[model samples]
Target: MVLHTVNCPPSHPALGQCLRLLAPGDALLLLGDGVYAALAGSRAAAELAASGAALHVLDVDARAAGVLERLADGVSVCDDEGFVALTERYPRQQAWY
Candidate 1:
């Protein structure tokens, strides 16, 4: 399975393209401005919640973006260590900037 990292916002094509290509066993990480999608009650958050991929948000970025506390229920929070862990866990990675 692939680990997909999206560094753009939900309104960007990167997020939508990433979502469309995600496999059930893939993992998706939202970082940088992409963390905006983790906000609860958002249309993007709803779509993300329904996705089959494991969802994660970089906590540092979320905090930096000021959306840490407002993240959707199913979005897992992860630190830099966790970011490295995900990279190590998945042999292959795809990044969208």
Candidate 2:
């Protein structure tokens, strides 16, 4: 499974491209402004839910945005250590900035 990191807002074209390119079992890690997509009741969140990809968001970023508790179900919040672990697990990363 691929580990895909997106660091931009959901409105960005890269986010759409990333979603289109994802294969089954791929993991998506949202960082920076990308964490907005993990919020509950969002169109992006809905799309993500339908994609069947594992979803994660940076804990720090979500906290900063004041939306940690509002994150969609099945989305995980991770710290820096967890980010490193994801990198180690995937062995490869595709970063969309």
Candidate 3:
């Protein structure tokens, strides 16, 4: 599985590029400034869901962005330990920040 961290706006070209390359076994970890993409009803969230890849948002970042309650369905909120677990499960990591 590939781990992707998107720390920019959803409309950014990087997001689209990443989505295009995402496979079923891939996972995305929305952290740092990337937590904004977790907002419900967003195009980015929709794109992510459509990719059929696992989606995760850092709980701390979500809370900081004030989007913790607005997260899209099927998106998991993860802590540091969960992040570590994800890295362990996914051998490749791609940071978009």
Candidate 4:
């Protein structure tokens, strides 16, 4: 499955559109302002979890958003190395900035 990265906020329509295209086994990496989606009850968070895609939030971004401690159960927190690994593991990547 292709790996997708969304670094935009929930208010961005692109985030929703991107999530709708994801399927199980796909990956979504939330970075930049997108870490806000990691908030437990946010709509973006719910949609991400419901889609069954592997959800990942950048550690630095999550901390900057002050949501590192409030991320949902299934969201994985990743560092730069992990991000690099994701790029290596997935052949295709779609970035939603």
Candidate 5:
């Protein structure tokens, strides 16, 4: 399985390309400006929800973006430790800037 970390905004091409490549067992972590895509009711949120990959957003980043409560359904919040755990869980990783 692959673990994908997207550090860019939804408007960036990184997220779209990453989404297309995701499989059912993969995981995706949204950080930095990428957290904006997890905002509830957003098109990006809808797309992410349908991606089939386990979805995660960095807790600190979501809090800094003021989107903790507004995060879309099915998206889990992860701390720094959780990030490290994800890296350990998956053998491969793709960083989307």
Candidate 6:
């Protein structure tokens, strides 16, 4: 399984590519502007939910954007240390900008 970090917003071509190529065993972490994709009622969030990959959002980023309370269901919040842990859990990582 690969750990995928998306640092851009959903409207970016990179995000669309990332979602298209993601496999069921992959994990997705939203950081930077990517955190906006997890906000409730977003079509991006719905797409993530359907991907069948584990979804995570950086807590610091989410809070900064004021979207922490609106995170989509099944999206887990994690801290800086947790990001490190994710890198450890998945031997391979793909950063989608």
List lDDT for all candidates, in order: 0.91, 0.92, 0.88, 0.91, 0.94, 0.95
Per-model RMSD to reference: 0.8, 0.8, 1.0, 0.7, 0.6, 0.6
Q: Pick the candidate with the highest lDDT.
A: 6
**TM-scores, in order shown?**
0.95, 0.96, 0.93, 0.96, 0.97, 0.97
> Taking the tens digit of each residue's C-alpha lDDT, what string does model 4 give over 1-97?
9899998899998898888899899999999999998899888789888999999999998998998979988999999999999999998999988
TM-score between candidate 6 and the true structure: 0.97
Which parts of model 5 are misplaced by more than 4 Å? none
Which residues of candidate 6, in runs, are more than 4 Å off?
A: none
**Across residues 35-63, which tens digit of lDDT does each residue of candidate 6 receive?**
99999999999999999999999999999
Give per-residue CA lDDT, model 3, range 1-97, as digits (tens).
7899888877778877888998887999988778878889998888889899999999998998898989999999999999999989988999886
Ranking by lDDT: 6, 5, 2, 1, 4, 3
What C-alpha lDDT, on a 0 to 100 scale, does residue 11 get in candidate 2?
Answer: 99
TM-score head-to-head 1 vs 5, winner: 5
TM-score of 2: 0.96
**Candidate 5 lDDT, tens digit per residue, 18-80?**
989989999999999999989999999999889899999999999999989899999999999
**Which residue segments of model 2 deviate by more than 4 Å?**
none
User: lDDT of candidate 6?
Assistant: 0.95
Model 2 sits at a Cα RMSD from the real structure of 0.8
| Residue 65 miss distance in model 6 (angstroms) | 0.5
The candidate with the higher lDDT, 2 or 4, is 2
